[model samples]
Target: MKIALFATCIVDAMYPEVAQATVTILRRLGHEIVFPSGQTCCGQMHINSGKFAQAEPVIAAHARAFSDTDWDVAVAPAASCVASLGHQQPMVARRMGNDALAAEAADIAGQTYELSQLLTDVLGITDAAADLGSYFPHRVTYHPSCHGMRLLRLGDRQSDLLRSVEGIDYVDLPLADACCGFGGTFSVKNPEVSSAMLADKIRTVHSTGAEVCTGGDASCLLHMGGGLSRFQRTGSFEGTPDVTAVHVRQTSSTDVGDDNVDHLTAVVGADDDDHLTPGEKGTSPAEPSRIQSGFRVGQSAVHLARILASTKEDPLRVQSEGATVSGGSLR
Candidate 1:
């Protein structure tokens, strides 16, 4: 099959490895891969921030970029970006009064697929280890991005592929469907709420005791990895007390101010371990034991494409120590 790769802005600029991995996997599957060089941001950020006017050209460029390129199908590693192709592009073009561009946008959206959707649905890849020679012998957990889960309705396609990886101890993340709080500009405009949501996610990830947190979207993983990195350094969330566990919950109908509206409450200094039995101190009994911190010193965020692209011959290195977070990049 001939495939055009839609390397999203984040993957193209910040994490080219992920794009390369998408190419690698396709090439490995005996498919031809082509890059549409004119591709830029899918205008998700603009559309998400209510800048529809700014998104018109972006959506037009994306439609033109892929339309000009000859391929049977287009695939992107980022589910959010792919979701935008179908969900927002046409609407944005129509709103701009460019019916021609809107038609083009709709056509392009139909041809685009998230990497896992292409792999599992189009290619019929049930076993990653067998079909793609995917091998990653490490403890890992997956976070399903919101766009992938809610918009794309890509249930189990990503995680199913991960579970098929050879020697991969795939652990089911608690509240796996929860958003990582990196909703593009949503995190920027609402930093406090984002941080609080991130804290809960990081704590859940810590409980999994996985060496790496993998996800389809680089943005969410980046958000999570940064939070985990900070926790690894300071051993606690910012302004959070040094407690065994901090439970953040929403108010229930029985006791709270308003019944309809929910409120976030942080119960600090709770003994999370007190309820566990003698042997279940760190382990969840159903899954692995909790690691000392959210993630180990060198634990890092990795894209799903990179993990799927991994093979026994040239395995992707998993860092074990001396990890650092700088300039909002997690390493």
Candidate 2:
């Protein structure tokens, strides 16, 4: 089968190894891989930030890029970007009153698939170790991105693949469905809230006692990894007291009602100093448990594609920077 690789902006610019690992897996399966050079950002960021006018051209260009490429199907490693192709692209085109472009966008969306969707649904890959020679001998946990879970409805496809990996000790992440608080610009705009949510995710990841936290979205993994790295470096979470038990209501807008605000305040409790934010400095702190003892201090955040592409001979190694696949370093 001929497959076109849609290396999303993050993957292309930040983590090209993910794209390369994706290609490696496809080629290992005897499939032809084609990278459409005209492809660029799918405009997910623009659309997400309400820049519909800016997103229209990007969505159109994405459609044109894949349309110009000759392939049976297109696949992207990033679930959020892929979800935007179907969920937001056509809407943006229609919002611009471009019916023809909207049609093209829908057509492109139909042809595109997330990596796990393509591997499991299209290619019928039930066992990663058996089918793709995936071997990751480490304690790993997966965080399903919101776009992949809610928009794409990619249920258990990624986790099941990870579970099938040879020598993998797959542990279910507590509150696995919770957002990692990296909603692109959402994180930047609401830094405090985002940090709070990220702290919650980091605590749960630490609880898992896993050496690595793998996920389908590079953006979320990047957020979690950066938070974990900061925790390891600073040895304390200052300026994030709300992170102790503050559950940021996952809503579209900032108009959280009194009930929600009350709920948020109610959940805030005094815990160990490790869990408390800087604001709760005077709170009576409990003894630090194993989850806070810096056991997985240098825990790695890896993309699922890299894990899937790993093998016994050419295993993906976790480095200080990130994971290296096939001896090629990722920047």
Each prediction's TM-score versus the true structure? 0.83, 0.85
Candidate 1 structure quality by residue, lDDT tens digits, 188-229: 999887887787777777766788889999889889888877
Return the clash pairs for model 1, or none.
none
Candidate 2 lDDT, tens digit per residue, 121-156? 999999999999999898888899999999999999
lDDT of each: 0.81, 0.82
Deviation of model 1 at 312, angstroms: 1.1
- Each prediction's number of clashing residue pairs: 0, 2
Write down the lDDT that model 2 would get. Answer: 0.82
Among these predictions, the greatest TM-score belongs to 2
